[model samples]
Every structure is written in structure tokens, then in C-alpha cells.
Target: MGGGRSRAALVAKARESIAEGSKSFTVASWLFDKSTRERAHLLYAWCRRCDDIADGQEYGFRDGARDLKLDQASAKDRVEAIRILTHRALDGQPTADLAFDALGLVAAECGITREMCDDVIDGFALDADGWRPRSEGDLMRYCYHVAGAVGVMMAKVMGVPSDATETLDRACDLGLAFQLNNIARDIWDDDAAGRCYIPEEWLVEMDIPPGQLMKPAYREQLVQLAGRLVSIAQVHDMRARVGAGRLKFRQRWAVLSAANIYGAIGKKVHARGEAAWDHRVRIGFLAKMGHIASALKETMRGSYPPQLEPKWTRGQLMAAARMAGPVAGVPNTPLRDEGVRRKED
Candidate 1:
């Protein structure tokens, strides 16, 4: 990627990063071909690094994290640093960081563009700004930047054509599905971490006061909201399956398997109802294997057409990401990070 860095060394670090950052992803990645696997791992390393930097965590651990400005202040600085480093990585410049270097490598090999990387970085910028969704559209917009864009990059790593818009949308759908599930499962934890992704309108409708979501009196209402998030996730997951059919067998299998595994978390969270936040929900090993088996069976059958239409399209959300509230009645701009733009009215 840069002058002296060896691809092998970068790949090795990437392997370690994925192993430590996401066990589920590591398991799913093994299903990819060798070249795709390496590239996927490399891309994941950068994404993981940026996430950790944005959240003030190291390797996904958030314990005693306030010292890193987990809430604000330096969080904004951290986001800007991420943007600068990502820009460097996209430019083939040495960033003096393995994760950013890995991004440079993957972007070079896979045709990932500056826009794709910026789309993801936008999510971190939102978090840094202490921004929250005011509506369902806002929530999905956040999900698009954080996870959907990354999914599109992942599809490219799998050798998906740049012109495959629907496939890319499906890929983005999987990311949105995953993020929605995460929000459902981690609603309390995110609150504990001084963050919340649930839309303000939902909270107001439920009459759950800010920062009191976990209070015993409001637990049921919170569960209802969580269920809604999961319901939305399920729809995206279903549509994403259709997109998976467009991939090669192994890629499709890996994607559906991972989808099922993550989907299990949201289902379990919803099934638990009021008790969902009592402990963190996780898919067990046997359950993971079962999902994998189901995916294999699903893979054997020919791909099915989607039975549902998208409630929101990537193009629409991306357009939202590219705008601030209004600049002299001009909505679009080249620099679209959260620091440069506010949520549109």
C-alpha cells in the first residue's frame, strides 16, 4: 500500500484485528475464497480501528472508557483524525498505522472509492457530534452511513461489479439490518455508554424520559420500541437474502449465514421482551452452527426474488448524508461529513 509495508504483514495484522474485534465476522470470513478473505479481513481491520477510535475503545472493549472522551469533546477530534487518515489511505500515502494501511491496500485492490470510505466515516462523525435521530428516516440514515456503506465495500471485496446497483443496495440492506439488530440488542448498553440510536419521536410517544430507558417503570415500553427495531431489521434481512443470491455460492452462503446469526440476536432480544436487557444477547455456538447449516441448505436452492419492496432506498439516504440543513437554500456539498453538515430539516 505504502512504500515499505508488505501485504503479507498487513494481512497478518488484519487477521488478528478481525479475530479480536468480531468472532462472528471471523467465522463468516472463512467461507470466502482466499483472495476475498484476505481483502475482507484487511477492510474489516480499518473499519474496526476507526470504530474503536470513534468510541474511545481499544479492540471493542469499552470499560472505563470515559477518559478517552467517549462522550464528546475529543471524540470530535478523533473523528477528524479518522477522516484525515482515511483520506491519506485512499490516496496511497503512508498513514503510519496498520489499519489505515490495510484500507489503502484493500481500496487499491478492490476499487473502493473515497466516497465509500467517507460514507462510513460519516457515522462516526455523527456519534462524535452527539447527534440522535428525530425520525425513522434519520435512524436509517445513520445506519446507512455506519453499516450499509461498509456492506457495499464488502460486496466489492467479493468482486461484485460497481454497476451492480441492486446488489449493492442489498449489501447495504444487510448492513442496515445488522445495525438495527445491534441497536435493539445493545440499546441499554449504548445508553450506558452515553449514546442512544432510538428516534426521539419514539421515546416521546412512549413517554420514557431521556436516560431513563432502563428504569423498571419504562422497561416494557422500551421493549416495545426494541421490537420495532427488530421488525425493521427482519425486513432488511429478508431483502438482503435476495441480494445474496446474486453473489457466488460461497459468498452468498457466508452472507446468509452471517445474516441468520446476527438476526438471531435481534429475535432473541425481542423474544426476551422486558428481560432483553438483563444481560447482553448473544448467539451460541450450536445456534451459530445451526444457522450455518441452514444457510448451506438455502444456498443449494436457486436464489429467490424479493417478495417485498424497499421502504427506503440507499440513494435517498445517501443524498441525505450529502446535505446539511440548508446552505443558502443549497442542500448538497462536496464535503459531507457530520462536522461539515447538519441533519437536514
Candidate 2:
């Protein structure tokens, strides 16, 4: 949209990426006005591309995304590639990839920042390094980079000003909530991938040895830990709902619908107890519609609770991320792909 391609063409591709990558988000996006919806799609395209490259997938679930494998060397190189392209996009240099160019368009329009993009990239870097959370705090920090920062960017796309810190915090809360539900939902798949987000301390506390989380004898302990995770998600979900109440009616409707839909997944995981992982947790089309209807009704309900005591805030998380230092050490070189151009469009 902002580089060499026509806006219409760029939009079509971005829309396709979202339509293919995430059903839940694609459905929720419909609640926004045309402009907001398109910008959201554009942002999601870049995020999806980065994730796909890092994981050796296409979009997210299609093209044998699950079956594809990424070794440590490939993972690191891919993460670096994403970082280079993102910086190129942000600097208004040619990135070649349509997704990164889409990021340039929306970022130029909405004041999305370098720090915001960096935060999201840091998550991919962590995954590339095979990093595991050692504490509950570490788990949330990973969530903040992976999802919370995306929430902040989404808030800006929906017209929340850059300085709207409180609203942005709540947006980040929504992202944290989404990631927590993901952690609860994807535990089995994550184990299969040789990645686990469960804090080491929690595993130690439960006497579940490393890599034995899915063993029959440790199932109860796993359930208990997942229950705790969902409980934490509910708090951030509540805070997010409260923040949604401050948005325009349509925006609020969309945000709350997503919140309700994802909150349901986390709740179901808790409700299922031992059988939680028998199948992947998902809401059907009908259930999604039901949540959409419920969200409209929730929009009418009045004031939130006087306090939402989130254990972590976006400010604190940002500070912690700063302390941890840069995600990459080496400078980015030009891509070897034929599509990558030396000249800016």
C-alpha cells in the first residue's frame, strides 16, 4: 500500500492473509468500520508473516504449518530476516515483502512506533533462542512481547492516540489475556514442538520433572497449573472489558466480542479439568456468533469495578524488557531473495 503496489492490491493480499491465518480475529474484525478494519488487517498481515517465517509455516495454520519444522540455526536466521525487513519498512526503505510494506503504510498513518515493532519482534527472538520461562513473571514478559505489544498497536489502529497510556495498558491487557488463553490451549502442541512456557518454578513446585508434563502421573499437576493460568487470564480479561467500554460503540463491540470469545476458551479449559487436552480448545462458528451477541449486550452494561488489580502493568513490563536489552546483536544485511531491492520505492 505504501510502497510500489496499488493500495487495492495490497489490501486484498493483507485481507487474504488474515482470512487464512485466524478465523476468530477475522470474524471479530468485521465489527469495526471499514478504515479501522483494513488497518487492523494490514497490521495482522505483518505479524502473521513474521510468525510464519520464524516457524517455517505459511500464514499460520495452512500449508502444513504444524508439520513444518525449524531447527535452531534456521530459526535464528529467520528471526533476523524478519527484524531486517521490519526495520526497512519502518524507515520507509523498500522491504520487498508485501506484509512489511503493509506495516509501513499503517504505521505511517497511525503513528505506530519503532519500540512497538521491536517489542513484537523480541517474542520471535525469544522463540528462536529456545528460551523458556523460569518464573511466572518471565512467562508474562514473553506474553507482553508476543501479544500485548500487538494489542497496543491494535489500539492505535482503532484511533487511540499514541499518548493514551491508560487505554494502551488495557489494550496490552487484552493481548496478555489472549496469550494466556493460548498457553492454556496449546500446551500439548507446544510440548510436541519442544517448547514449553510453563515456568520452571511451577514445574518444580508440582514435582513434575522437566519434559514429563504430559505423563499420565503428572496430568493432575498440569491441570492445576493450567487452572492457575486461566485464573490470571480472567483478571486481564476483566480489565480489557473495562477499557473497551471507553471506545466508540462499534470498536467496543468488536473488542468485547473478541474478549468474550477468547475468555470462553480459557474458561472451557478450566472447566474441562482432566479432559482439557483431549482435543484442541476452540469455539464453533455458532458459539462465536453467540459471543458476538453477548458482547453487544455487555456494551450496554454500565460501570466497571472500581479496581482491576493486574499483577503486571505495561509500564512495568516495558521497563523489564528494557533491562533485558536488545533482541539482536548483529546489523541486518540485505536479503538474498531476488525480490529484495536495493533502492527505496
Candidate 3:
């Protein structure tokens, strides 16, 4: 968004740093021409900064939980640090700190809801404490707070209709699905970090030891779990496809392309199981090219696929029902994507 330099270059770099190749918005954003790209780059930079902070990455440093550990500071200290840094960044005051300050300005100018930003902080706090949910509902709440809030912020930036809350709703669902995939993928790695997001209840009900599951014996069940989550993800995809169908041609295709790329990870998880440990499941380069091409064709045709309906456990239904009014609607957003993004990016 900084002018006087090439806008395309800035956006290209921002995309590399923030969403890892422009994320789901890439297809639609390409339709915006130069001005929108520049604005979106600044917007993504703001988002990336806040995301890095909440996930506790150090500025200009790739590997460290240093920022997350700061949660150990007194609550007053944490609040003050966030507030001061946020202010400085907003004022463009030169300082060692920039995350919160810069993000505050972006939120103010972009109409990103304050509540959504706070929810991201809240999710980070939960992570810092090494908290794990006892039930599915608790995990869902965490997902909604962390990832679903991103959906709300995105809807604001993209100029979604005020009356089209369902688009926002589907976006939230898409975030949830993304998160759930992350949780499924990170079972081993999270254990290494002394954290676990899978609900304790699921383990207890299945009589699987959390530790043993980390081994090879539970590979089949892990695949089952992976299948179940992928099914759930498909449902979210359906809702998003439906929701995007209501948007402009470019926006709808953008949403569909992203969903397809992210959701396809489930297939890799299904096939390889623990081999997924070696490298993250990713859509192949050829597949990515195909996805882009298909997205363009589909956009022009206004063709979107029908989504698969997910079968939920009674508990999952009950949990979604609590936060989102009913299982009749889509379940609460999934919390698992953060881990995936952390590893893949």
C-alpha cells in the first residue's frame, strides 16, 4: 500500500509473507486491478502482523514461541504492552514495536469490527495458557473466537452486503473448516509443544490414549477421524459455495478455489496418514494451476459444485447448536487451521 514503489511488487511480497500466495482472495483480487491490489496488500500486511503476534511469532524472526510466552507476564503488563504498541503503530511513531499499533489503524480504517480483533487476542490467550478443551463445544468456541473472527473481518473488507449476513456466515464456516483440518493434521506436532486441541472427551470415548495415538497403532482410527473431519469440511464448502453463488462472479470463484485447495488436503491426509508428518499435505503444483484455470472457467460460467452434507456426532450437533442457534445451520467454525498455516507457511 506504500505508494511511489511498484504496487504489484508490494502485493506480491505481501502475499508471500501473509497468506502464502495470496490465499483464497487471490482469484477474486486479480479481478480488482491495481488500486484494489495495493489496498489489499496493506490490508493483508495488517492482518499478517496481528496474526503473527497472536500466534506469538517474533518480528522478522521465523522460529520462536517468544511472543506467546509473554502471556506469562502479568495481565496488566500484557494489556499495557498491547495498548501502547498498538497506539505507536497507528501513529506511525518509530519504535521497536509495531504489531498492535499498525493493526489498530488498519481496523479503524477498514471497518474491521473491534470485537473480531478482540476475539483473536482472546484465542491467543487461550493458546498461551496451554489450554485444551474438555469437550467439543469448548473447541468450537475457541475456533469461532480465533478463525471465525477472520471471516468477519474479511467480509468487512470485501464490501459484502449488509443484508447478506449468510455470506459472512458461510465465510465463518469456511474458516471453521480450515481450522478443523489444522487440528486433525497437527496431532503429533502439538504434542511435542506440550499442547493438544483435540477434546479430551473424544479420546476418552474412543478409549485411545493420547500418547499412544501419537504412535503408529492408531493410524486407522486417525484416518477415520480424518475422514470424518473431511466430511464436515465438505459441508462447510457447500455452505460457502451456496453463499458465494450470491456474490459477484469473481468473488464467488475466489471463495470456491480457496475451499477446493484447502479441502483437498484432507485427501492427502487420508492417503498418507503419518507420512503427512514428513511434509504438510499440499495440493500439487499442477493441481494448483488446474484449480486456477478451473476457477476462471467456473467463474465465467457461474458454475459451482453442490456441497456434501456432513453427518455430525450428537455432541458436535449439540455444541454447534449452542453457539450458532441450531445444528440445523452449519456447525461452529473449526479451530484447527491455525496449526496448519503455522507449519505450511
Candidate 4:
């Protein structure tokens, strides 16, 4: 098949692969619209494929096959996919890799830098390394590279002005919050695979070994820590909502819908605590549809709330934002245990 034919097949395949037509709330909410739907599918496929390559190496492959397991082929595929869409976008041809193609087109059309994409890929690459993060900040840095960069990319794609610096900053904050939720949600699964992304320092300071968390003895402390993480994530959730007001109508609604859905998950986590391990919490289908309707309502009004205060203090926001790089000079508060355990940067 030619490129056009292949692209069509790819889109159809993606929709079939992602039942309910989305992998997450970010895409799931707006996917009813054709344009956004296709783009969301393609973006999900692209990001999912990249993540799978890095993660696939850990599941019972022979020792010798590890290198091949983590080969650069998936990354190459993403690049080629983007290249085709980028060309079509430049030529003013409607492209097939909708989400990613839109991503490329928007980035190019708006002059958004490509460094953010590179950073996302770099963070995914770190997954191939058999290392546990030593601090919550380290974990956030990883989250920023893999997820926060995507938030920046999406903002640029939406054509948000550089002068809307405050909004852009909050968008970045939302990404980290969402990723932290993922970490809290997937702790059991990640630990089972010998991949503990939770900060080792925090665990140590709690007088807990990550392995022992599996025991019932540490259940209360685990619950408390998990609750705290959820609270921290709420700060970003608020930032995201406030930031959404600064976007154009359509994009503003998109961000709000997404933030609402994901932010709801954090609430579920806090309520359920260790129960998150038993089953991942998801907003009910009705709740999701409701969120979409709410976004549309706000979009039609053309008026987003202005002058909303940030839920987090300036100091807290800075700590979350600096997760993208080495963290130094940041205050460390005491956890359940009294002693301090600072990891070397």
C-alpha cells in the first residue's frame, strides 16, 4: 500500500486497538470529534510503542536477548512517523498521523521547539536502565522528562503564546501531577517487576524497605505516604485548572476536561490508599461523559475563570517544576520516620 493507504490502515488499527477509543482521559474525553480522535489515537500509539520497547525487556527474556529487546527500532519508527506528517504539514496536505502529525504540524506552524520531544524520548530511555530513583525529586525529574515535556509540547502545539508563561508553567505542573498519580497508582506493579521508581530515600527515611511495604506491618505508614503524594498531586491539579483559563476556548476546554478526569483519579487514590494496589481506580464511564459535557459547557460560554489562586505556594510549585533536572537547595521535610536520608545528586 502507498503512504495514504498505510496511514488509513494505521488509523483504523489504532482505533481497534484502543477500545472506547482512548488509552487515557486526555484523549478519551475529546475523541468523539473526528479530528481530535484520530490525532489522539495516533499519539497514544506512538507514545505507547516507545514505552513498550523500554519496558518489554524485563519480562523473562533470555539474558542475551536484552539488547535486542531494547533496540532503537521503536524510536526510529516514531521519528519516521513524525517525519512523514511533518512533511505533509509543511506541504499543507492533510496528514494521517493525526495526533502526532497534529503535534508536528502545530509545533512547526507555531515554531515550537523540538527539544521537548527529545526530552520525552530521553526519559523513556532511562527506563531501560535497571536503577531505582533515590529521591522523590529524582522520580519527579524522570516524570518531567517522560511526561512534563509532552505537556510543554502540547501547549506549544496549541499555539499558546510565550507571554502566557504562567499558564505554560501550570500546564507543566499538571503533567508532573498526573505522572505522580501514575506512580502512586502503579507502585505494586512496578515493584513486582524489580523496577521501583519510588524514591529510595523516602522509603529509607520511613524506616521501610520497599520490599517490606508488601508486608502488612507497614500498611498504615504506606497509606499515609500514599495520601501525602495524592495531596501533593492536588496542588498541580489546581494549577492546571487555573492555567486552563488562559488558553483559547477550544484548547482551554480540552485542558480542563483532561485535568478534571485525571485529578479525579488522585481523589480516588487518596480515598482508597493501599487499595490502589488491588485495582487501579478509574472514573466511571458516566463520570467521563459528564466531564466531557462540562468541558463543552465551558467552551460554549467563552469565559474561563480568571484570577484563580494557585493551590500550591510559590515554593511548592518551584519544587515540582524543578523535577526536570538535578534538585539542590530544596527543603526536605520529615516523613513518618524522624531521620533524614538525602540521596546524592
- Model 1 per-residue lDDT tens digits across residues 1-345: 642499999999999999999988888889988998999999999999999988878888876735533547788888889999999988989999999999999999999999999889888878887787777877888898999999999999999989999999999999999999999999877887778899888999999898887889998899899999998887788889988998998998899889989999999999999989999998888888998889999999855655555566788788888774211123223322232122233
Query: What's the lDDT for residue 337 in model 3?
Result: 28
- Spell out the clash pairs found in candidate 2: none
**lDDT for every model?**
0.86, 0.86, 0.56, 0.58
- lDDT tens per residue, model 2, 126-208: 88888888777778888999999999999999999978888999999999999999899999989978899998989999999
Query: What's the lDDT for candidate 1?
Result: 0.86
* Ten residues in sequence with the least summed lDDT for candidate 1: 334-343
- Model 3, span 294-313: residue lDDT tens: 76676677645543433332
At residue 193, candidate 3 shows an lDDT of 58
Per-residue C-alpha lDDT of model 4 across residues 1-345, encoded as one tens digit per residue: 112334566666556545533445545435335554554445555455445444553222335544433344564454445445445544546665434443444344455554555566656545544445676655656666767666765666565676777767777777877877777776766666556666777778778875776567877777776776676676666667667777666667777777767777777877886676788677887887787778677656644333334333323433444443322224332222212222233
Off by over 4 Å in 2: 62-69, 306-308, 327-345
Which parts of model 3 have CA positions greater than 4 angstroms off? Answer: 1-16, 19-36, 58-102, 303-345
Once superposed on the true structure, which residue ranges of model 1 sit more than 4 Å away at CA? 65-71, 325-345
**Candidate 4 — which residues are off by over 4 angstroms?**
1-23, 26-41, 57-112, 293-345
Sorted on lDDT, highest at the top, how do the candidates line up? 2, 1, 4, 3
Q: Tell me how many clashing residue pairs each candidate has.
A: 0, 0, 9, 2
Task: State, as a TM-score between 0 and 1, how close model 3 is to the true structure.
Answer: 0.72
Root-mean-square deviation of candidate 3:
8.1
